[model samples]
Target: PPGISMAEEARYGFGQPATEADIKAWNIDITPTGEGLPPGRGTVRQGAAVYSNKCAACHGPTGTEGPKDRLVGGHGSLATEHPVKTIGSYWPYATTLYDYIFRAMPFTAPQSLTADEVYSLVAWLLHQNGIIPATMVVDAQTLPNVTMPNRDGFVADPRPDVESRE
Candidate 1:
């Protein structure tokens, strides 16, 4: 209270609200139902090229062989003691994959890939995991429909899930 001032408080009311473009740019969240999906498309074939140029360095030639968290295979290993919870093995919804890549991916630059590029990556990852055909093109409509292997495995927990004070 000694160092605080009323001027600081007044400044809080002086700031301008976020513009429409600014709101849209920051509100890039995609839903499991494929809501909020940007208009774009990417095929597993084109994703192959995108992945090679932008993703392979971290995720390896294929999504599975990468040094980072593997994005392919491990389809039936969830119940095993050593479960590999990859995008295919553990992800519940396909659009969630798109959301993740669009929000944070490529390790080098976050939120850098275009909607189409992210779509391609999702397709290739799904293809590598045998969830979809290699020629499949992931767009808003098809992406939300590509269910993952563990879609029904996760049980919703309705609880007092507020953040702990710790």
Candidate 2:
């Protein structure tokens, strides 16, 4: 800490200074209504190709991994005695799925996919989960339209006693 200069310390204390342009460049937030979704489309079939080329090694061929994270097909298992929560059944919002995968997926390499490639991957995963048809193309227009089965399953946290009473 002695080597740290006053100016450097001041800059650090000021925290990260980000510009609007910088924020715009890195801001990739996608809403549940498809707001901020990029312009692109990908079919389930195309996604299979993309996955094999970009995601298969880490996520496994069928999305069930031997060593890495599993990305698909664990529906109806969450309520069972032994549950394996997956994107198929556990995820409440499809848009969140797309946003998450687009931002951080493939483990080692994150944010390495184009908008179209992300859409393709989403389509593939949704199709694998039986949430969407294989022929469906996931895009900004349609991605938000797909109704997730567990959309209403989660309840808002009611912590009135803990916060108010405490």
Candidate 3:
């Protein structure tokens, strides 16, 4: 925290100044909306094959049998004493799914999947969880529209409660 004033950093920076383009390039964050959904598409059938080849090794063939994380099922278990929070059970949004896969996945390799591959993986996972039909395709338009089962399960964060009502 010491010797890191904003003025000093702006005047004579110890590192190279980043351009607007550079900032955007590094800002790969995708919103809950369809913000970063690239122009790509993938069907459930196609996703099945992709998952078998690329993801099943880690997440299991059905996503529910994974040693890493069980992505499917676990609905209505939140009320139980020992709940199983999973993608089908606890994820709030589908865009978050797309974003996560795009940024970090495969365990062995991150940022390795193309836009299409990411879409396919999301589709497969959603379909395995029964969120979408096997015939359904995931794309920029469809991915954001997917509503997770536990969408309303999370309560709003009650932080900064004393903020001024300006």
lDDT, model 1:
0.85
- The residue ranges of model 2 lying beyond 4 angstroms of the native Cα positions read 1-20, 159-166
- Residue 63 Cα positional deviation in candidate 1, in Å, after optimal superposition: 1.7
The estimated TM-scores of all candidates read 0.82, 0.80, 0.81
Clashing pairs in 2: none
lDDT of each: 0.85, 0.85, 0.85
Please give the range of 10 consecutive residues that has the lowest summed lDDT in model 3.
8-17
Per-residue alpha-carbon lDDT of model 3 for 1-37, expressed as tens digits? 5878898867755677889998876676678888867
TM-score of 1: 0.82
> Candidate 2, residue 71: CA error in Å?
1.9
Clashes per candidate (backbone, < 3 Å): 1, 0, 0
- List all candidate RMSDs to the true structure: 7.0, 7.1, 7.2
Q: Model 3 clash pairs?
A: none
What is the TM-score ranking, best to worst? Answer: 1, 3, 2
CA error at residue 97 for candidate 1, angstroms: 1.0
